[model samples]
Target chain A: MHIVDGALSNPVLIGGGLLAASGVAYSLKKLEPEDLPRVGVLSAVFFVASLIHVPLGFSSVHLILNGLLGIILGWAAFPALAVALLLQAVFFGFGGLTVLGVNAVNIAVPALLVYFLCRWGLSAEKHLLAKRVADGLFLVFFLITIWAGFALYQLYQVEGGSWSVTVNSVSLILFSGVMAYGYFLYRRGILSVAGFWGFLGGSLSIFLTAVMVAISLALSGEEFGKAAEFVIVAHFPVMAVEGLLTAATIQLITKVKPELLHAVR
Target chain B: MTQVLGEVSRSWTLDKHQQTQEAFLQSLDPRVRLLVCVLFSCVVSALHDMMALTLALGIGLGLSLFARLPIWTTVRKVVVVDSFILVLVLTLPFTMPGEVIFSFWGWEASREGLFRAAEVGLKANAILFSLMALIGIMEPSVLGHALYRLKIPIKLVHLFLFTVRYIDVFYKEYKTMRMAMKARGFVPRTDLHTLRSIGYLVGMMLVRSLERSDRIMEAMKCRGFDGRFYILDTMKSGPRDRIFAVVSAVTLLGLLAVGYL
Candidate 1:
């Protein structure tokens, strides 16, 4: 999601920079002396979270963790995020300095959402361990899905001028439904290995229908993009690997030091 | 040259890494510097002609010099931060629409593009320089106070102040981790495994950070933080500040007028 230096129109770049500066400046003004240490840690966390990747079929998809970072940092998330992204752009060429504002705004919105969601949800008495985890995961999924919709729109504007608007609207709906169900499975813990294997057995009943779509698409040769899209979407091996690793890491943390979740602000 | 440039670039890419231009900053009100930042940005965007871009560049350079910023520091700020811009500048002939200055491959390079890119490069450099000058002249706390003085939303300003205030914590932890890696011989040479190791290391850092936040917040509450941070506002605009503002504005306008008419 890095906007290279010259990729945007000049007005957008400068305008975005000004807005980001405004946001960062505002964040700076609101900070208390005691909030310093947490800002440091949260910045570190947000910076590092974006580096972990899950391999997708054509390309790798990374967990942004903007949601989690925002959940933790509240209003303080933007400055930390801006700095982190700036560090990435400057050091690693992940984004351009020109579009640093755009990058900050993209990620900061979701991170802020996480803060609000947790602050409100956790404040409710009905919060359970399962609910907290679900809520966290749900927020991440929704945030990502929304951003993905925006991305599709941007791409459509680039690639599909006249049809772009309608494509965006329909794609967003389709994306939300698919993303939500996947998130549901994640929330229910069915995204794990044993649960995944159990769910695969039911799809076995409709295996022929799915196979026929593949056969017809392949025979026609023109519909391969659609077929490949399915392959891209259904590629479980990569996600399984990531999910297992994530689960293992979390389990390690929980076992080694449950105090991480125990001590709450 | 690539390695040395890369090393040099690595060292000074972050604007704050250089020695500040605090000498000129001594005389001004923080509020004026803050206004200078806005007026400078507005001028940067408003620039459309070569003469204007050049004049603005000259005046921005003068401002930096007035702040007593060293030439080397100013050069590093431009070279390191805007290399991508240099890349775009080089690519301009391919993308820009106008009369051809040169032809090669399938595309002809445009004279207009060369000029346009020069304008862009100049404008971009001016933005960086003017900002550096402001940062140089103003203490970050002063910058914060200046924003508070401007009636910017208190929440946003507080975040930047805190982030800048505590960035050292993250850097220190990063240093320790790097040192830990070095001691264990975890140097990254040419290998994808190294990338993976770095990725895992990054993951671990996030976990460590998440673990760190609760403790920090608890400590903040102990200090009677009711959310409002005050940087004792010591700045009241005086004669020098007024002159500085008027002179800068008039000079910028004169340049703008020369460019258009």
Candidate 2:
């Protein structure tokens, strides 16, 4: 999801812009001349992946592939994602050019972190259990980042407010419950098949939805209560569909190109 | 599925619009256009006053008209991207806390939220339209060259250039892979099968692209290509370009002064 222009305050915008600039600069330095083709191909893949729409009941959810891209590309995801976002803004009008920096940060930073956190889990073990665990950890990490960042910010802004308290409590319980269930599944190896991707995908979509809610509250200046309501009530099933789609993709990759998975690092 | 395919194809051809248009925006120096758009966006982003934001939006609309962009197409593009903003604009009145403007079903709509939403909406629309008129009408290669001349990092520009160059090719490859799957009696469904198929499609595309890039690198090296991109189209700011830049600068500065002071 793209943050529209003028939605964020100047400090956040400028801060995000600077951070994204640094990331791209670093990625540029790290980019070897020989690897330009790899970057280009991956960038194209990332761009097209966003265009793939998985059918939901009434509508469809486009593939974000943020976690997948991050794990594959590492720090390189920054520049690649930035260029894709720019084209989206210019051509399809998916995002605004003015706020491209903030949007890149929102997607790329989380992606980089996921790469660092989950790469080991994905690459270390060949069993389906490891995949499930990696995906679960990614979901857990995402949930915690959103809660700690946004819930705390809201709490500080309106000390002891009922709305802030309610959001924090709800997020903590819901997120913890998901993580616990995911861990339960991971431990039992119940989804130790092709469906592991689906489970992970579902978790990732839900995590993204939660993050979107938090962003709307924190950056978009939406009343937290309303934004949370819209996300939780309206987008619940889209997460499941996204999860299924992601699962299928991972399964396919594992079957055909096992080397690609390990080679990403 | 076709909608998605249509969008991909459409995005790839967006650069063609710059080639077709003969508007003043197209003729102006791209570097000037880039700088002005950035400056105007920053100004629009910093704007708080409603009148000032509306004024900025009017300028954006006016520019689109002058640039000879299709009005309905521009509106549709802006609306598609700013749909979330539209929701915020509509709901802010009811959700934002301030003096009650109205009440419906025990929900009080506030005047302050309405104003804030309008301000944000105006800014969003303003920037969207301005960019469509400015950046939307520029060729990607030219834009890349402009960024290079502006002293942006060489690597980033090259990546941008190559990415733009190959996006369409890879998309076509993706289409071919999907078609091959279809030819094999593959049908998309809400199951592991469909996802796996798509995954295979994506993986296949990636493998092909990696192979293709190697070939491309060889071709470039064989053609005496260096790391730098050289533009054949020379940029000389004629009196027309100079006049447009000055007018745009004055208008933007005037708006900032009026909005802030």
Candidate 3:
């Protein structure tokens, strides 16, 4: 979810813009000559993915794929997603040009986190269980970080707003349940050989979607419980579907070219 | 899904309504237009007062009219594009703390929220309309050239051009894959089985895309391609572009002054 032009306060915009610029600068410096085409191709993939909608019951939602991009491209996801977003702003006006920097950071930062936490374990093919655990841990940790009021402060200046004990406790329980389910899938040996990859992918999709919705609503000044209700409850079905798709995709890749996973790591 | 695909492809079409319209905005230098648009958006963002926002919006509307862009369609497009922002505005009245005009279920519509929402709405609409009137007139190639001339990094520009050029090709590939899945009796449902199949579809697309990228790299290298991308459209900022710049700057500054009052 993008914060449109003039929607955010000036300070947040400038701060986000500067941070995003530095991330891009670092990415550019880190990029090798051989990596240019890969980055460009992945950029096109990300751009096209948004156009492919996944049908929910009545309405459909486009794919974000930020997590997928992060796992594959690492820091390169920053520049890659940034270019795709720039085009989205120019062609469709889905996001404003002025807010491009902040929008890029909002999506790409989590991707970096995914890369840092999951890279080693995922690369070690022997540690499939470790990879799933890493993904689950990172996701739950990520949710806790956001739901703990960090997003409310970063995105909006909402004061005197507290998550009701009831809402917080409920969300915490639900999130833990998700984490436990992910672990169960890993242990049950669901899909034979790379089932855990699918689990990781699905969990990442759900985690990213929840975080995106929470921040978007928070920035719009919605209270924590309301945002949580919409993200956790309203988007629950979408999360489940997204996870399954993500897992399947990961499984296919692991079957066809398992080295691709190791390559990114 | 089909609707979104069509809309995405349609947005990239080179020949649109803005091309046929012979307007002053169409004639301005692309670089100047880009700069002015950025400056205008920043100015709009800075203004807090509705009076100033309304004045800014008036200028945007005037420019759109002068450019001969269809008014109704432009308004419709702005509304559609800013739907999320509109939703944010909807929350303002009930969420913000101020003197309440209406209260329901413990939520109050405060004057401050209403005022803030209007400020955001006016600013957002003004920026969108102005962008449509100004930068929307130029071709993507021309805009890429302008960005190059404006000293944006060459690699960034190259990445942008590649993404734009190949998006259609990849979209076609994605559609074909989806069609193949459908042929195989795949129906997307809320179940894990269907979701897994869709995942295979996405993975298959990525693998193909990566392979295609390698081929593209080889082709480019065969043609003696370098890291630097050369912009074909050579645009120079002439006196007319300068005039547009001066006029726009003066108008924005004047609005800023009025906003301060």
In the order shown, the candidates' DockQ scores are 0.11, 0.44, 0.50
Computed on C-alpha atoms, the DockQ of candidate 1 is 0.11
Mark the 10 consecutive residues where model 3 chain A has the least summed lDDT. Answer: A154-163
Sliding window of 10 residues with minimal summed lDDT for model 1 chain A? A197-206
The C-alpha stretches of model 1 lying farther than 4 A from their native spots are: A1-40, A44-76, A82-103, A106-265, B1-22, B189-192, B210-212
Candidate 1 lDDT tens digits, A54-119: 444345655454544554466667777876674454334345455578667655654555455444
lDDT of 1: 0.53
CA displacement after TM-score superposition, residue A140 of candidate 1 (Å):
17
Q: Write the per-residue lDDT of candidate 2 for residues B1-261, one digit (tens) a residue.
A: 123212221221225456455565776778888888889999999989877888999999898898877667666777677776766567667767899988876668898977877887888888888887887777677777777778888788878877877777777777787788889998777654675567556667665665676787798789886665565555566686688889988998888888989
Interface RMSD in Å per candidate, to 1 decimal?
8.2, 2.7, 2.7
How far residue A219's Cα lies from its native spot in candidate 3, in Å, is 7.9
Where is model 3 more than 4 Å wrong at Cα?
Answer: A128-182, A192-198, A201-241, A262-265, B1-21, B70-76
Better of 1 and 2 by TM-score: 2
TM-score of chain B of each: 0.83, 0.85, 0.85
Candidate 2 residue lDDT tens string, A94-188: 66766788788877876776567555655554765666666656566556545554645464356444554564555455445544554465458
Model 3 chain B poorest 10 in a row by lDDT = B4-13
**DockQ category of candidate 2:** acceptable
Q: Chain A TM-scores, one per candidate?
A: 0.55, 0.70, 0.74
User: Candidate 1: lDDT of B99?
Assistant: 88
Clash totals for all models, in order?
20, 4, 2
Candidate 3 docking class: medium
